[model samples]
Target: MPTFKKNQSSTPKINKDNLNMAADAFKESLVNIRNSKTLHYIQRQRKKISENRSASEKYTEFVKKGQDKPRLRDADAPKTLQERGSETVNRFVKYVKHHRKPRDERAVRHINPKHLLWVLGGICLVLIILSGVNERFRAPFRDAASIVVVPIQKGINSIGLWLSDRIEAGKTLAQLEEDNKKLKEQVENLTMTVTSLRQKELELNRLQELFQISEQYTEYDMVAAHVIAKDSNKWFSTFTIDKGTNQGILKDMNVIASGGLVGIVIDAGPNYSTVRSIIDDESYVSSQFEDTSELCMLKGSLTLMEQNLLEFTDVSADVMISLNSALITSHVSSTYLPGILIGYVVDYQLDANDLTQSGHIKPVVDFADLQEVLIITKLKETSD
Candidate 1:
């Protein structure tokens, strides 16, 4: 028979929360007999009590006095903020420690039973292969077979590393390509800008030629006007002379430069008059070479642009021209007066296809930007 140990009343312990936990533990243990390690002894004692009818009568009275209602968990359980926080912290710590996210392979494999089986089968096959190769893997057997393949697992690892590096290299290559493209575009833009500047330089040189021509003929009643606006093409080399009718300019008046005949005044408006430049294909003048004193037709065309070009052409191919030969207007010129400067003939073609030599004449005027100009008032002389 088992002896029951009674609780000692001397041990005093009470904290409301501790009491609840302890009471719950006690009730749980008592209600569940399977939880008791000493169940055999408890049963023997119960059997003894049943055998003795008087003992049974005493046990019944004792059981009645001692038995109380088991503790039940409350539906509205009260917990402190600290307890809730502690629980949350514990849960988070556990979650972090054992947080194994589903691998991509695992998710796919689980979804497909065939894939899972295939992978397992492959694993088994590899194990069998390793087992079969184990005997040959030993040194003596490997030496006998002399064709020892080291079974390069490192090769696979190297391939993985190489692939990763290549990916990084590809990104670097893309960046370089972008940089190269930007640099190329910038170079093209710079080239275009340089070309435009060169054209403007040539124009300025031509306008400067006119200025030099003016210095030679100081006796003429001439005033300079800038060519304000004009067409860039050969068909319309006309522009507005800044010095207009307000400056006593008239219609049917001949406009000239110290260089040569510029054009006739097409229309003399209030403040301005349009004059065609000699560069226009329609312009033609009689010219004489100062060195040879030979008369020839001087024509203008826009074809001569190689390196910083001009627009003047020679009508007589036989007209002797050396470097720095001065070309001036003859007295026979219909529209322009005699002794006006055209330009210096630096290069010329002695032989021609259209009875005229095509050549370069460096003009005295800077045509790109002209601040000062001389218009021959004598060309527009009024009747007294």
Candidate 2:
């Protein structure tokens, strides 16, 4: 009997840990219940019912206002849920609307797409047949189509032509630019060729003149030489030739050019020789008229040579010298060869002494520009 008594001390006591575990289990059960599909379906049903109730309320209000039936979408103004679900097979059936007019008993049938296509094809076939049989049947259709199609076709053609013209213009411009470049190159080449030809022509003319001079003095053995240097002045009054004692050129040797007597060598080296021209102030030559043996003294004057003239003094007053009289070296000259032309008498005047005359003479040689000259190898002494 004592053992059977309840053990009060062994009874389990409640604690915070146990209470917290019980609370967590209760909250997890609540979350699971809330997330269940059945609960979500119930919520959706409640929302749909509310929406339907509001739509019905709106419809009732509209009816109470005594207005004609208001237009409403099926989703916005649905009928009773039971009625909508009961007619599942009805959704697949074609709907026939009954007209409220005089033909209320007849149902208005909608047009089927397949039937409409068939009808259009039949009509087109009939038109094609009739157009082939008669011109009148096709005329109206063709004219009507052209009224729209012709303008469109013409517009397209105009655009095509404009684009083609632009392309052609661009091509033409490129072609012209190329041609212009070629033309410029051709012009440059032509200019160079003409310049070279001009130089050659000048050389040819100079050689011709030298040839003629050589013919004029065929009696003397002459050596051709080029002028190598000259004084700084414009005239070749004193110039060096590329000939000296090595070439049988000696001091006092006579020099001649294209016209006549040029000068006499004043200094001679082994390779070069200097000549003082007739225009030199210190130059003097015994001379006489070509036709007459009357002697005259030809003198150089720098001042008168400016006018391409020299001085002729010591001429006897009785001499028959006139303008343009030919003057030549006299045989009595110690240095110059005999009968060599010097110049022409351009002017003369009786000297103050009344025994002699003086005048200006234009020399045959151009001392201002001398390029080539001839040296008679035979000296005046040897010639004598």
**Most lDDT-accurate candidate:** 2
Estimate every model's Cα lDDT from 0 to 1. 0.60, 0.74
Weakest lDDT window of 10 consecutive positions for candidate 2: 96-105
Overlapping backbone residue pairs in candidate 1 total 20
Model 2 residue 337 lDDT?
87
Model 2 agreement with the true structure over 1-384: per-residue lDDT tens digits: 112233478885544444445444543555567556556655455455455344445446645665665665554544888766655446544232211222422335456779989999999999999977865675565455445544464456457667867887777777989999999999999999999999997897799797865533347888898776678775447976766667898778899987588889876665567789888888899998887788888888778878989898887888877789889988788998888888888889999999999998888888777778999887777455
* Candidate 1 structure quality by residue, lDDT tens digits, 1-384: 223333477665443444445534544555568745456555445455455344435545556765764444365333898877887798899887555543432465457788778999998897679757763333343333222322232344356557867887777777989989999999999999999999997886698796764543446676666554455564566766555656887554665554544556654554555676555566676777778877766665655422324544555766556778877777666656677777777676754475776566765544444333456666623344
State the TM-score for model 2. Answer: 0.42
Candidate 1, residue 54: the lDDT equals: 42
Given candidate 1, what's the lDDT at residue 44?
Answer: 49
Q: How close is each model in CA RMSD to the real structure?
A: 34.6, 43.1
Please name the candidate that would achieve the greatest TM-score relative to the true structure: 2
lDDT, candidate 1, residue 142? 32
